[model samples]
Target: MLERLIESLEAAPMVQRGDYHYFIHPITDGVPLLDPALLRDVACAMVTVMDLHGVDKIVTAEAMGIHIGTALSLMTDIPLNILRKRSYSLPGEIAVHQSTGYSTGQLYLNGIEKGDRVVVIDDVISTGGTLKAVLAALENAGAEIVDVCVVIQRGEPELGRAYTPLVTIDVDADGVRVIDTCR
Candidate 1:
């Protein structure tokens, strides 16, 4: 399952930015174009490895994570909660500071409550900063994170927990190469 996704990504458009070679996948960068089939492939691969039983909600960040989260939510009939970059002054909304390899900002959490069992998903894990921040917020909210999944693992950051990543990639001046597979 992951081999198919990696093949598709390797064929996708790539642009070099300094020391990093970015693969412009539709699910992450919204570039090169949107491929529903590819997205479904990714979601299917993720669902195969995830333990979805008893999970109360599926949480993810805005933009890229939305697509994967929505797919998983539909697959398991679980509710999906997106952590938005913009904060809403609604009751019970909580915000946390997040610093990714690319940018830093505040991600607002909504619809999560105490004792909720959740599975967090993301597009990529480069620095693990975003996931770290989300984990902190979820801990503060008293929610139990059952599992963490990322489509791509770009860097080896100690997230203090285990996460299932479909494809582990390494990018450099040469290009992006699949270094390992999580499945």
Candidate 2:
């Protein structure tokens, strides 16, 4: 189902950041070029796999998740919520702290009201720092998490919260190796 995603992942280039083997691809890195066909394929695949029914909104962290959330929302007609790096200072805004394998930053959340159902989507789940912070903020905001999914999963991230990974891969100095896929 994720044919384009898998192909892109296999062809992704890898770089070593300290001891971390980071794979750079269009979906995660926004480099090389983001193919529209690949994005459509991923959004369609997610629709088939995720239980998105009754979802009030699609939530994602800023940067990489923005595209995923946008595509998925377009496909499903669901509203999208982007937790941004900058604050709007709107009422009921919540600040989040995220520490990932490569970087750390503060993200702010808004628009998600109490009892709203949401599906969280992201580009990758390496170290799960961004997703971890996002989930915590969603919980504190009193939103019901309908589903959580990612396009690529690097290694096994102990995110505490359960998540659906569309494809799993292993990154090395050489390149990225495909490990598994959602049924």
Candidate 3:
């Protein structure tokens, strides 16, 4: 099942967590380019999670998640929106500021009208900080968040329906493990 795939991901060190090996790797390259096969696996996982979560549109951050989000969006036939960290020359775009646990950044949401349903996408969820900002931005734009999907979900679950991670990774002590299980 999903657990096997997650375990495999963990075993590969594809995603890392905290200062530990919640995942197999931390994506230190900031890009999954090192392993095309791994990237493909992550992309496939994203698509599957999105489909299961009933996601309509994919919303993600500007730099890191752009490639992964685009790939997943294309795979799922869903529209993609890039949440810019700062507003550029684009006019009429709704820009809002929020804090992720890691840092504070601005989110620019474009082309999405009020009341639209969107699913947030990212390459990884370390502390859920960036994802929190994305969620706030979506809410500010009056869009309902259908779910949050990532190639890997780090940290312990918040539970209680406050938020849901499409995937949970498990890694071994030696920075090697598989995606133990996915939720």
Identify the leading candidate in terms of TM-score: 2
Residue 150 in candidate 1 has what lDDT? Answer: 93
How high is the lDDT of residue 4 in model 1?
69
Instruction: Write model 3 residue lDDT over 1-183, tens digit each, in one string.
Output: 344445445455434456544333423234333454555666676655554355557888877788777667767778888888666756557776656444677777776668878887776665776677667767777888887766665666342234434465544566543343343
lDDT by residue for model 1 (1-183), tens: 676678866676677767667777776787767677878888898888888889999999998999899988887899999999898988988898999777899999988999999999999889999999999999999999999999989878779999998888887655678888866
The segments of candidate 3 whose C-alpha lies over 4 angstroms from its true place after superposition are 1-28, 52-56, 89-92, 98-101, 157-179
- Give the Å shift of residue 132 in candidate 2: 1.1
Question: Each prediction's TM-score against the native?
Answer: 0.95, 0.97, 0.70
User: Model 2, residue 1: what's the lDDT?
Assistant: 60
Q: On residues 76-112, what C-alpha lDDT tens digit does candidate 2 reach at each position? A: 8999999999999999999999999778899999999
Q: In candidate 2, how many Å is residue 1 off?
A: 2.6
lDDT of each: 0.87, 0.91, 0.62
Backbone clashes in model 1, listed as residue pairs? none
